[model samples]
Target: MRQNTTPRGLVQAALAMTLVGTLTAVSAAIARYPVYGGQAVRYAVAAVILLAVARFGDRSRASRPRPRLTVREWSLVAALAATGLAGFNVCVVEGTRYTTPAMIGTVVGAVPVLLAVVAPLMERRRPAPRLVVAAMIVTLGATAANGLGGGSLQGLLLALGALAGEMAFSLLAVPLLPKLGPMRVSAYSAAAATPMLLVVGLLVDGTAVVRIPTAGEAAGFAYLVIVVTVGAFLLWYDALGRIGADRAGLFAGLIPVSAVATTMVLGLGRPSAAELVGALLVGCGVAAGLGRRVRRPAPVIAVTPGRESVRVAEASRP
Candidate 1:
């Protein structure tokens, strides 16, 4: 109502998760592709697209000077690329060998709680109790949505690594976002991640790395490059800067819900009652975490001619 960016931030966060969640299924299209090699391509393509859009397409942004990165900031971007981008894509793909996707998703679902706890601590403040509790609720909702599927010990570890990457994706960017902004951060991180992923692809696939993709794999990579990499990164990082990591983190719960919804849309399966309840809980948790408040008019005091105060029935809204 007052030019508040929080609502916009919330919407962006939701949209980002939607892209990520819906694309979760689409990723299987490229399952046969070399994992590291495919991701390297995706990141490289996305970085170019982002850089072009950020630098050339936005004329309004031309006047604003871009910030140069300090050494520490460069280090952070490197770590973010390595762990959050390269490591996450590799482990998440590899993890499926040891367990069900639901189990891995269930473990990775803890990102909300992780961000809610760690983000505030990074700022030298105690975590907000309400936000923390809401994060827990969202985590529970995600777990329910994922059906609490079972996994092997190694799968559990891999899922934990994915969780760390997801957490780092936001927390590390918290420092960089204010300086570089979302577009630059997205652009730079994607560029940085390409080399790392390509190296891994080379090591893993040897001379066979970076083969020509099939039609379906090409389509899948296009979707990832345009939506999940370019669009989701900008949306999430911008939201994180606006509403902060704690609040934005709650939207991570939507990943599983959106995945379920996508399955339904694709006629793959119907959602169970637990998933319905989980979606409801996710909505409730996000609403509560955002501090949705209602206001009422307070009783007012009136001054009579004698300057004495008299009780009045109503007052304007505060």
Candidate 2:
């Protein structure tokens, strides 16, 4: 049986991509701050906010006691914190220092491709042929849109690190989402990462953490904390729950497309011909990857006592 895609899942995926893509510009704006310091501050704030919401804000869920994480579950949360939140942010921030935003965007766009490959291994089954083809197309489009230029060797390596971290983040959280739900998973992951980020920031950057951010940096930081870290993580994980990781992962292709559009909106850069073509390809790939095959109802055969079987066709349900 084919899996069905829902509008809610699609909207969640789009919102996730938009929120994450906006981070490209946010990162650029705040690049001057020490890498660990900026990320630590951003995530620390996000963690606090998410924890508050998880604890006090959901009146509808207030009756239910919060679920406590078992040792095994805590271990998974710790892993997610390390790979997805803290490690991913660190790599991305450090990578931006050495590389252009476009380069980083291009590399990050490969996430879906990595997920497509890894999902099967984790699930112990082969991916569908269409998924593989769609992943390849998305990769090609992302590369074309974000041209491979203006980045150092160190930057490229760091970007690869970021890619690995992100892939781990997405794949690792899938199993946990069903048990904990998206909000709890996100809150715990952020909470776990926050202290680690703070410690790293203090150890690496020292007094920089105390220094006040400039107006633009402050704005960017707010966006990252509120939108990218909290909002995006919740939406993405929720979409993963609704659609499953294999389908949800395909939305990663939209990140670069959204990033380029964001850049243009910010008057930072214009899309080139290659980027335009690449955007089209990404749209096509996502549509194909998420498209569901409609199954026709099987013909009902009535067995008769006398002789022949009568075939009856049932009308398709809406």
Candidate 3:
């Protein structure tokens, strides 16, 4: 079934994700300074910011004006938050330890592809052939950009897992949109995931959390909280709500392209001609695939608050 699609909202969401990816890559570079895990540091910081927002952003909603969730709904939301938000963050950070930032970014870029596959599976449908092709091209480009020569097996593995984490997040989050609005969904997810992450961070990093970070690390942590965590989540869920999860995911492929470019611009490293070509091809391929949006019928559930979920639209899938 097709849905009432919103082009402008989708574009804005894509732009937000792209910005998050770029900023995340740069922050990773900055995190390299303190010998603490950039991924862990950024996430821990992000959790704090998210909690603050969740607490203070909407005091009216704080008491939960909506009806209380059934036990099942709470469990589902917790699982979704744990795997999608929490799991993705942890894996990406841990993956960076074993992989190059470029490699991590590239693999992370493939999240759209993963979402394409996973979304269809969740909906009990088959994905389009063009999406499959786009995903493959993006994968090949990611492999090339990550210096896929020899002796990089560990990085490759970690990168792949990171991609999986991202896809898992996207797939799990889609169904939750209609149940919990984007703000509450994200806030609750982040808040729920915070405790577990804190425990993990304490166990893994030890006293590092209390230790003062260098100027650069502090800046990186702040950027991650402001940009990647807060900005990215808002845009991501907003996109999911506007378009179906599948189309929204298509734009995710731009992440690695942005990350690699950002890295090169910062003089950390330059992509070889081959890598550059790969990045562009991946970016273009994903965009081209997404550009083929066919108007479809609206979902059975109302995504917007106080509005009916179903809408009159065409009869093709994304």
Candidate 4:
């Protein structure tokens, strides 16, 4: 079943990160809106769009019986909505109040290393040393790109929470991706997150929880719905399914890198020499980690009655 799909997966991962990076600028328009309410609207619209596309885009595929989600899958879907979607957004918004956005972003940059170690554990495999080293290099690159920024202890703690949420975003989705596929997983998670955010909006903001957005806010929501939520979520989950999470996590460094590039392009700020160095390191790390991986042959076991079993590695494929 496996083929030369890594290159395509890499491209998808990179594109997804780049799109997400642009949100640093795009989200500005919605800053004045109610946080939970705005998020609710974004997910609601995104879920609708994804459902339509996934349901109708291909006639043959659409005609096939829709796969039923198991109880475990439903639980995973709920957890994803809670931690990755709602919880992550809450941490970020609250984190920025206590810490500089740079600090929060830099903290989240550590996700590469976190995923390198944790993802393999989730898969019940030993984490590869090469991948771990590469993850460290990527984290370093992320730090250089974002630069060290000051924040309170509480801010630091909140940033750490954001990091955990970001990691959960990938780790939680790994199991579901293979079965539900990217489209359903993304659509389902977005749909699940919608009500949670809406209820939070209601409790927190009262009757004014949702207001008619201004033109700028509307435009921002449009980008978020179509590009950030729909496009990025689909591409990210698709890449995760294709390439596996540890390798895919490395591309997350591109998020801050891409954000910095966007700033430079818009004349918001010129990147420093350190930022340039950071970008280079990210490229190098990704290259090293992705070096042609050979799937190890499975082990064979022999059992005879009244004798100790024998286990040995199978011969490698030519």
Candidate 5:
């Protein structure tokens, strides 16, 4: 059994969270283009990268042990890939096509809030009242930040669907994290998304991703698939393993902040003062919910031959 955790774990977790946030922001930027095929593109790239990594780094199946997920677990993985990869892509892409990329960014930014509210439900755990209050506050902020309550009701609804799909991905993926190592899970998840992407690509792009994609576009797609999807998962899972799920989850709140920062750097969309404030509120809510009090492990009391040793229980925040 592992005896101790270290500072490296925390560093890895922070880096992973930041990278995920950056990549998501990048995805938002280039969301135009026939990238209507994000699910396929993401999976195709991810499969290639991960299959390579698995082969080179740890090809010994016996040493590592072959995955032994039950049928239910496999089903959950499929559902996670479909909802997180396919559903989010399809909804966000369609929403972008119908409305604007800026709007999509704003909508997607609300994912942390959705995850915060949905997490307890997935774990079959009752949430503290603070979590509920935080979620409500964040929801209100997101509504205002996205201008979702204003015009473009159709696009807003589509964005909401995308958020729901993402929440499903987060909740569904939780149980699988313990069984499938994060890298393996990501590889399989991407593999699961391949067929869906292929089907959509044939119908939408028609061999165009290879034929028409500029070098930069291809690079972007590759980055999304291999680096963002695969690398991000590996780092994220490592962090989650070291820190408990709740603490690991709080980092996700940084995604929208990263998105807005990227947008500002690109000079694409100038986030309004109100939008910034809204993002802050939403982020605060997400962190608050994910910060549900961590119950520390009880201390061990040692009994000597003639005496009992009193050990004080120490609470450690994950």
Candidate 6:
């Protein structure tokens, strides 16, 4: 595990929150357009942008031989594309059709809890007590923050589907990190998922797949493509490399808070007192869960050419 805190890691966390924040705003566009078609367009745009960057943006990367994935790695990448990109978008878009974005956001806040449970099982170890407690606290806070809002049974079930997709996507990607690095993993996953989404969109949305989006819808779709899909995924994977998935997952607790703030900004409504209280609990729980006591490094002894060895203290963890 990475022992030191990093500015990049913090930025990744912020980007993750930003990604979630975009979901509510993007829901407006999804509502305006066909769900599968909108998603297909967004992913296709993002895939093209990412692939272009990967292939020709930097001279050194362009010159290096492209990284080849083993059959197993390729299989994992396919799974990541399916569950994380295509499946997640489809589920979220469909779920939002029957439920409010706030409710969906609240449901997604369970991701950290799912990760806390699954990460230990994947590693063949018992779950940490503190992590378990933190997960529970986060869940409670998320539920309260959303006021336990009611939605249709189908909507709730679909929201759960999205949750499952998200959990699977995250867990599956962890094992592939060493082979493909974050950007390649994200770029390839997006590219792989684009064709799948296009096929699905054609089948489900019919000729609506070819419809052009309005100015507002286009703006929302662009944000979803550039900021949420590409930028957020890259930042998330990068942070996962630095902090390990378990700790990085806990940052998901911020999603509901961001969603609520986004809602208010859109003039939806102010947060209720309970929601404010819940947001505070979420903040505290996330801090407690992620907090670690850094171990001091052993002092190093330097050997000078003609002098006695000198002891020097190493830099502390940030």
TM-score of each: 0.87, 0.85, 0.75, 0.90, 0.74, 0.84
Q: Which candidate tops TM-score?
A: 4
TM-score of 4: 0.90
Error of model 4, residue 77, in angstroms? 0.3
RMSD of each: 5.1, 4.2, 7.2, 3.5, 5.0, 5.1
Clashes of each: 0, 0, 7, 0, 0, 0
Per-residue accuracy of model 1 over 190-302 as CA lDDT, tens digit each: 99999998898888898777889999999989999999999999999989888888888999999999999988998888999999999998888888888864566888777
Off by over 4 Å in 2: 1-4, 57-59, 96-103, 150-156, 294-318
Model 4 stretches astray by more than 4 angstroms: 1-5, 57-59, 293-316
lDDT of 6 at 303: 69
Model 5 global lDDT (CA atoms, 0 to 1): 0.65
Instruction: Summarize candidate 4's per-residue lDDT along 38-142 as a digit string, tens digits.
Output: 999999999998888877855657667787988988999999998899889888888888889889988999998889889989879999888899989999998
- Model 5, stretches more than 4 Å misplaced? 1-17, 23-33, 60-62, 99-110, 134-156, 207-212, 240-249, 267-271, 282-318
Error of 6 at 255 (Å): 1.3
Q: How many Å off is the CA of 45 in candidate 6?
A: 1.1
Clashing pairs in 3: 2-296, 2-297, 3-296, 3-297, 3-298, 301-309, 302-309
lDDT tens per residue, model 3, 73-129: 788778876777667666766766676666676657666667667787777989877
Worst 10 residues of 4 by lDDT: 1-10
Worst 10 residues of 5 by lDDT: 1-10
At residue 68, what lDDT does model 1 achieve? 80
Alpha-carbon lDDT, every model? 0.87, 0.81, 0.66, 0.88, 0.65, 0.76
